[model samples]
Target: ILEQCYNLMDFEAVAKNTMKKTAWAYYSSGADDEITMRENHSAFHKIWFRPRILVDVEKIDFSTTMLGTKCDIPFYVTATALGKLGNPEGEVVLTRAAKKHNVVQMIPTLASCSFDEIMDAAEGDQVQWMQLYVNKDRAITKKIVQHAESRGCKGLFITVDAPQLGRREKDMRSKFTDVGSSVQNGDSTDNSQGAARAISSFIDPALSWKDIPWFQSITKMPIILKGVQRVEDVIRAIEAGVQGVVLSNHGGRQLDFARSGVEVLAEVMPVLRERNWEDRIEIYIDGGVRRATDIIKALCLGAKGVGIGRPFLYSMSAYGQPGVDRAMQLLKDEMEMNMRLIGCSSVDQLNPTLVDTRGLSMHTTGVPSDTLGLSIYDPLVN
Candidate 1:
């Protein structure tokens, strides 16, 4: 099964069979009914491509810079917690794979491996970023941020969406218990709690817009809000003096019916263009991005890059670092082929004219049959 895996979705199928039920539920489940989870992938189908012919796309350049670092592709690994649950080597496996492929890997706040351990795993000039889950103790948050900066982390991606962990019923049903007290907060050390609740107890629910300035005062690393869903917040993010934003819903794990990041991108791009602030702040998105076409669509609508979380985790779970390396290679091949087919020679050439977004915001009845995402959330089947 591992050798048969070619794409991220194949890895996902293999991972379901390889991983423990509790770990699989924790990684795959979204909030409540998971309507938004399914929507994230299906939303891509709503967008139709307007490919141009007779254009010379013989020499295509898929390389793009993200947060001042150049990546070989337009997609990078997003932060997903508890990597050791997927593989014993944990986030270190991802670090090795990212370095091998010249892509960035965002280290999660709740990673099974320590911050320095993940950093130490990197070889050569590999660029890494830290995903911050703000602690209730501001002093602790400051210390973590400064430490990451000292260790050569490129950016600080602060997760802003989860004021409280959403109701992920699949995890609740599994009754998955967290292994140890991951964070040093004096909170409940009870291991009986589910994965989300146990690890997230240290996160400060009181986090607000006013705290952004304090974060700016702490470290010089670029601050990107990781869970922005509203257009008005993007305006606030620009005014708040942050470097960038990742339009995401915590991979649909935070808010059940929250709009997909791609859908939010569709809404926010026009507003940013109208305000003449589209290029002022770097924009990235993550949620239900499975295919190369999904990444291309995001770039066309003005994303500096796209983040993929679960797929990479699944790949690592099924086949370790080699699985991740293979997944990246497959995406690169797909993007290069699609670039020629779409009549674009480079990432910058992807524009609004290349996509049709008329059906993006419209409500649909059932899950579209074309996507594998819908079945992922169906507990009875998996």
Candidate 2:
């Protein structure tokens, strides 16, 4: 174990150095020109904290509840697919780490490990949520949902974005570079999606608000729409009668120029407050959650909790289970220090007043997409 992985970004460098290039491209690649992916991280720079003093800051509690579940922290291990590519132990490693931290883990539908394998890895009544890419086959989707509920899953995060997987050219380039072996599935196996989207091609493009009730009928788990982008869609989500909605752009994997999750959170919360609908549903945002302050900003903007995906995968990829354990601990430490410095004693004390989102919506740096530069670029250094 390297003792110097001081923060989340440190893990990225480790993972990049540790993992194979093909796996790195798949794990790191965003949609189209990856404009939104970069923006997701950069947007957090816009929000500034309003710290207070002359108050009791001796103790700080960062624990919070989401979708009627208690979590040790306000961040969940958001779903990411094909964990085996990162480490041979696959998603089960993440499951054990989440259980240890008492943090919720949202299991991806396209996980390298089977649903049973991932759930079986859990100890006791460890809460895990399901991330569904609604299949075209309604029966198959229903069976998957109901089975998840039967196996003690608490929440259903239906991915409302990514009807079709975006063309990640870097990932595609890996396929082109590979001299595939015939013993596996033959030369005509159609390796266009490489391994990441191997099992993800069945996502139904026609999923809409009308299908919410159909999902409700099949399972009793709290239904959370995972890719809601705008305030209007959030209002529609409330009208659709779901239990929660995640403000995500599919981790900047589905759309090219879509707004970052925190940026959208700033837009959504004020409306929820105006309509007095903040209590109607739980709201979560994933993407660009690289640090504790980013998580704090999202919490201040009325997000129930933020989801962190890539960093854990990077840590797990580079150092396995121990890496993930340390990654979670680092965030917990940062949260305590930052919350105390900002004069916050608990997660509930975090509000819109704690942070200024005035610059959150502004895109000051217009980064023109340079294909070759992006190909060799190291975003972790930034």
Candidate 3:
């Protein structure tokens, strides 16, 4: 059954069928009208690739370093909380798959398994990063960061986009309505607030630039600000002395109509180059990245790497660890094939000339058609 799934979108269709209604809603829904959610994927189509041919395409290399850590691929798994909603093993399934693939997994603060437990599940020398949803209490935040550092988490990815959870209408509707009958009863904990609100309630809304120094003082881990939507913020993140920035809109889950990460990357790259901060801080992006070609587009626009969230969750939901492993392998296969076709033998050979970005920043009305992602929105079966 798993072999029939050829791409990440196929996994979503299978996961939608396999998961409970509420779980599917929680994983798939974006803020308000989901305009930005659809835009994130559609934005990639606007950029046309200019692949070179007949340039000795043998020996394509996709391996690169993310924040100084060697990764076998150019992309890594972005953090998604409440993994138990998808599978019995939750984040641990991801850990095993990432370890097997030699890619980094950013453990969420609200993971079904505790931080230490996920670390314990890792094999020796498997690099992991911590994604922090800062608590309202400073003491709690301090303890969590310190603990993650002690446990060998290589970097700190601070989620700065969400001070409060956006109104994900599907999750909200699921919370008020009952879809529990169709959901499989796994080992997931029951929450009165449902998946979206339950884990996000403790997030510190007061998080601001002032907190960067406090975080710096607490841990020696490299800091990368996630959810930076503007070039201005990217400049602020660099001046604040952080190691990196993730150009993301929080998977379009927060802030309706916020620009896609790839769009933001296009706006930020030139400024970074002019300021000569390109090498000083690594830039990464997440959202609507389903294809290997999408990764190539972001890389050409100067993203160090890209992050994939929902596809991995869907893969885990449909086939557990093996599903996640297959998903990674598929991406690796695509990257190798695409790179060779683009006449690039290595990830470093990619540049802005490889793509046309004229339509990227233009915003259009209505949700663009995505049959695979839209499959999850069908009325739940009871």
Cα lDDT for residue 36, candidate 3: 91
TM-score of 3: 0.91
The global C-alpha lDDT for each of the candidates, from Candidate 1 onward, is 0.86, 0.83, 0.85
- Deviation in Å, model 3, residue 274 alpha carbon: 1.6
- Residue 192 lDDT in candidate 3: 53
What's the number of clashes in each of the models?
0, 0, 0
Considering summed lDDT, which 10 consecutive residues are worst modelled in model 1?
365-374
Best by TM-score: 1
Clashing pairs in 1: none
For model 2, the superposed segments whose C-alpha errors exceed 4 Å read 176-189, 363-382
| Residue lDDT tens for model 3, 1-382 | 9999999999999999889888898899999999899989999989998888889887888999998999998888999877877897789999999999999999987777778878999999999999988888889889889999999999999999999889888887787233232222112234454566655667789999999999999999999999998776777787799999998998889999998998888777866776667898999999999999999999998999999999999999999999999999999999999998888998899999999876764442222322212122222210
lDDT order, best first, reads 1, 3, 2
Candidate 1, position 180, lDDT = 60
Q: What's the TM-score of each model vs. the native?
A: 0.92, 0.91, 0.91
For model 2, how does the per-residue alpha-carbon lDDT over 334-364 read when each residue is reduced to its tens digit? 9999999999999999998999776864442
Comparing 1 and 2 by TM-score, which wins?
A: 1
